[model samples]
Every structure is written in structure tokens, then in C-alpha cells.
Target: MPVYTHGGDIRTAQAAYGGEVLDFSANLNPLGMPDPVRQAAAQADCAPYPDPLCRDLRRAIAAHDGVGAEQVVCGNGAADLIFRLVFALKPKKALVTAPTFSEYEEALTCVGCEVTRYTLDQDRNFDLDEGFVDTIGPDVDLVFLCTPNNPTGRLIDQDLLESVVKRCGAVGAVLVVDECFLPLATGGPGLAPWLASHPNLVLLRAFTKSYAMAGLRLGYCLTANQDLRERLGKFAQPWSVSTPAQAAGVAALTCCPHWAAEGRGFVEGVRPGLAAGLTAAGCTVIPGQANYLLFRLPGVADLKERLLTRGVLIRSCANYHGLGPDWYRVCVKGEAENRRLLAALREVL
Candidate 1:
């Protein structure tokens, strides 16, 4: 497997590098999985068939996000929902930002959709500016955008985001704003309220990163467009969310109300020191609000492989569009882990 395709491939990395690896590749919560969530998931009854529509999970999500239960559609994960959305709509043309999530392009390509990429300039810290809003026109049938974008960890300006939503609405294009990382960012959630006004807008949310439930595979999308929301489930199997996952989602929202804020706080507290360490170790770090940092190690060769030899795994940005080979991403973990990473870097660099 191409390592850059996604992170948390400890099995593959271990086989190749021959030792236990500390994974900084996947951007999960520093708090790790909550004990309450674990208990709820472990005790879930697996004998009966799982709910095809994920009604109970939707109700909990709707209450947590302050939207109608019918407006919320649960899926196996954010990625599974991405494929379902693409299959349901099957848009002929799509617009996506470069250096964003890869699955958007992958899903769009599966439908033979001609994709137009608006590359974000890394010199500007990969900020999405007004020019991106201008790119949305009637010719584009679908658009995929990420706030607190993956790999880069930059959140799009709200005004700029709404402008894109308005432009997409005016052009009759569907806009999917993936806010998978927003719960852990500095700012609280946004854009779900916009669903009442714009039918073309879809907000993707997942319990994977914030709650560290990647193994649970619970994710959902919120939209006011009931037809499109219902159609999302049609393209996929009825039981997209498993029994354990539904219980976990409910427990995550109901029992763990303050979990996201705690995760955000942990990320906020450690990110600065982590960035400083990376800079002190001969890397230029980008400022971001997400639970991760993007940095470039100057004149470093095979940095990822070298780090692997030291039992550390980081997400290399080489496969990310609009990024050169030198760029890399690391999750904002606990103080000790962050220090360990820096110590390892001090040796490698």
C-alpha cells in the first residue's frame, strides 16, 4: 500500500520497518477513546440485525447538532458516506480543493466525474481565499471542501465558506463541506444552521477523529435536503452503521457531551509546543487550529523512512496534491508523546 494514501497503517509499517511504531500519522484525539464510549460499544447487543436507517443514532446526533433526526443520515464512516453521496448524485462535473481529503477525488472519479482542482497556495499557509468561491459556477455539479482541512490543518474562513455556499446555491451545485475536524478545532461547529436555507449544502461529521473511535466507524451527514439525504442511504447497504457503532455514537453524544471541548483543549494546549519543537528541530511549521500540524523539514532526505527506523510514524505530505516531498504532518498528541517525537526528530534531523 502507498503509505500516503492514509495514516495509521501500523501493521504495514511494522512489517517493513521491523519494530513497534509510534503512530503520529493518523490525526486522532489526544485524549484517546473515552472509557464510557468503550463500555457502551462493548455491551451492545449483536444478536439482532442492526438498524438499517440508524434511527436512534440519528436522533442522538440531531439533538447534539441541533438538527432534525430526519435531516441526519448515518453511515459506516465519513468515507463510506462520501462514496454513497457520489453514487447517489453521480454528478457529471465536480470541484475540489487540492491538498484536501483524497477520498473526494477518489469517489468522484469512480463516477467518471470530471474534477477541477483549485490548488491552495502553500506560501499563504494553504488558506482558502475568495478566489475559490469564484470558481463555483453552473457548470459544476458538485463541490467538496474541508474545513480545518486534513493534512494541512487549516480552517476555511466562515465568510469565505458561506460565500461558496451561496455561489453554489446560485449555480444549482451541491456543496459538501467536510467538517470532520471542526469539533477539535478552536472554533465550535458551524454551517449546520445553513442547511435550513441551502438545500444543496451537506455537512459531514464523524466520531472517528474527535472521539478516537476510528475502529467503530461511525459517521454521519446533515442536510435539509430530505430527498438527497434519503437518496444517500439508497445507494449503499441498508445497515451502513453496525450495532456497536450505533451504541457508541449515542453514548459519545449523550454521555460524552464535554469530550469534544476537552479534546479541543488538549489539542490547543499541545499544538504550540509541538510546533515549536518541530521548528527547533529544523522544520518550518504552519499555524493551524486543528488537532494536527503541518511542517517541512529543510534538506531532509527519506525523513519518513528514517523516522520509521526509529519507531516513529508520521504522515508524509508527498502524496497530497499541491505539496512537495519535504512537507509532513503529525497529530497533536500528549506532552510525553510530543516530546518523544521531538527527541526522535533531534536524532534523525
Candidate 2:
């Protein structure tokens, strides 16, 4: 079997270390799934096959995004939608960032697309720069941009993103903006305001993050272009998202608005406290906008092993391209869990 590495792989950790491991590897909301959404899923129809078209769920998403229902496409998760986009578009050449989400490259490579990387400068705290797009040529057919990027938790500047998309559009390159981490950040509707004007733009979002539905596997994509939306629908398998997942998607989209606000506040409240704890242990915590923070600790390789021995599972960034073995990423969990992580790190370090 072909091997793939991705986030939320806590099962491996649990099996190796025991079942009660405290996971900081997955950068989820940490509040757990919303109770209302859970109730909705429990009450939803389970016998019949889901709507192949996902009409109701798409309509709910359209209502939430204030866009037409036809523009939305639901999937098993953002991962399913991402692969569909790659297969449907079939770009010859694509640009993505190193030390970012591994799935972007995996999807691109599976379709035989040539993947190029614009490395994030570690010394600059992995901040996105406008110049990264300067090297893109007319031959490049797609640009995968991750906002509030995974592991690093850094967001690209709005203006710089606009510049990239505008230039990419001029060259007929599809620009996919992965906003999976956006809900974790405190803000207004980001980049969605530009979707109406940027036809070449595609936005991928998920309930897996802020809504705390990681295992529920619910996500959707937004695009103003009816053609691309249709193409994604065509390429996607029918009823890829389950009935329970569809209901959860709607419930999470509608009922979780209030819960999202509280979750954001909860994440913001814990981020600094965790950062301080990491800093106190002599780790360099990179400032970030989302719920996760990146840090560099001396002997991180050894420290990770020690943490595992202590039943704490955190993401060691050694495998992420352009990052070194000394780097690690930790998600901001609730106060008690965060404290447990801090205590483990302090002891291990």
C-alpha cells in the first residue's frame, strides 16, 4: 500500500503510546463538537441514501455564505473536495508553499501535476510575502494558497493574495484559497468579499476546525464560476458525503454560529497562555493568527520522544518541507488540557 502522512493521525499515536494520550497534534477547536449539531445528527435520517446532489446541505451552505446554492458543492470532507478540484481542473503545473499542508501536494501529484514550492522564510516567522508569486509563469495552471496555513498558523496578507490571484487570473491559472483554518482566527468574512469579482478564485472551507467536527468529516467549497462548480460536481462521486454528515453540515452551519463565536474566544484565550508556557520552557513560539502555534525547542526530536513517553502527542514538524527537526506545532486546547501539555513539555524539556 502507498503510504501517506497527514494530520489528525492520532490513532497511530494512541496505538503506540496507549489510548489516553493527550493530542496537541490535531489543530481542532478543542471544545469538542457542538451539542446542537450532535443532536441534529442523532435525529437525522440514517436509513435512506443521502441526496446525491446534496441539495438541502448545499442550500444551507449557500444561505450561510450568502451565495447562490448552485455555487456550493458538499463533500465527505475538505480533502475529498480538494482532490476533486485537482482532478477536475487537471492543471499541468501548480504552485504551493512548503512547510504547509501535505494534502495539497499529495492531491496535485496524484493527478500528475508538476508541483513547485515557494518556501516560507523561517527566520521571518513563516510570514507570506508578495514576492512569492513573482516567479509564476503563464505555463502554471493552478496556485494553491492556504490561508492561516496549517502547522505554521500564519495567514497571507489580503493585498498580497489579491495580487497573486489577479496575476494568476490574467494567465488563466486557477487560484484555490484553502481557508480551512480561517474560523479559528478572529476576523470578518475574509477573502469572501473578493469571490464575486474573482471568477478564477476557489475557496475551500471545513467544519472540522472551528465547529469541532473533525471526525464527522463535513466540508464544502465556494466558487463564483458556475462552470467550475459544475465540473467539481461532475467529478465527485454521488452521495460522497453521508446522510448524517449532510445533516451535521447544515446543523453546524446554522446552529454553530453562536458556538463559533464562543469557540473563537476560547481559542484566543488559550493561545497566549500556551505560548507563554512554551516560551517559559525556552521554546521559540512563532506568533500566529489561528488556534495553533509553531515553536522551536532545543532538542525537539528528543523532547518529542520524551513527550510521547509521557503520553502527550504533539506534531513534530520535522517531516514538513523546509522545516527542521527542532520545530513543533501545538494546538491551543482548553485550559486544563493546555496546562497538561505545558506541564508535560516543561518536564520533558
RMSD of each: 1.2, 1.5
Give the Cα error of residue 194 in candidate 1, in Å.
0.9
Which one wins on TM-score? Answer: 1
lDDT of 2 by residue, 185-248 (tens): 7663567667789999999998888778888788888889889988898888877988888888
Cα distance off (Å), candidate 2, residue 21: 1.2
Off by over 4 Å in 2: 1-4
Model 1 C-alpha lDDT versus the unseen true structure: 0.90
lDDT for model 2 comes to: 0.84
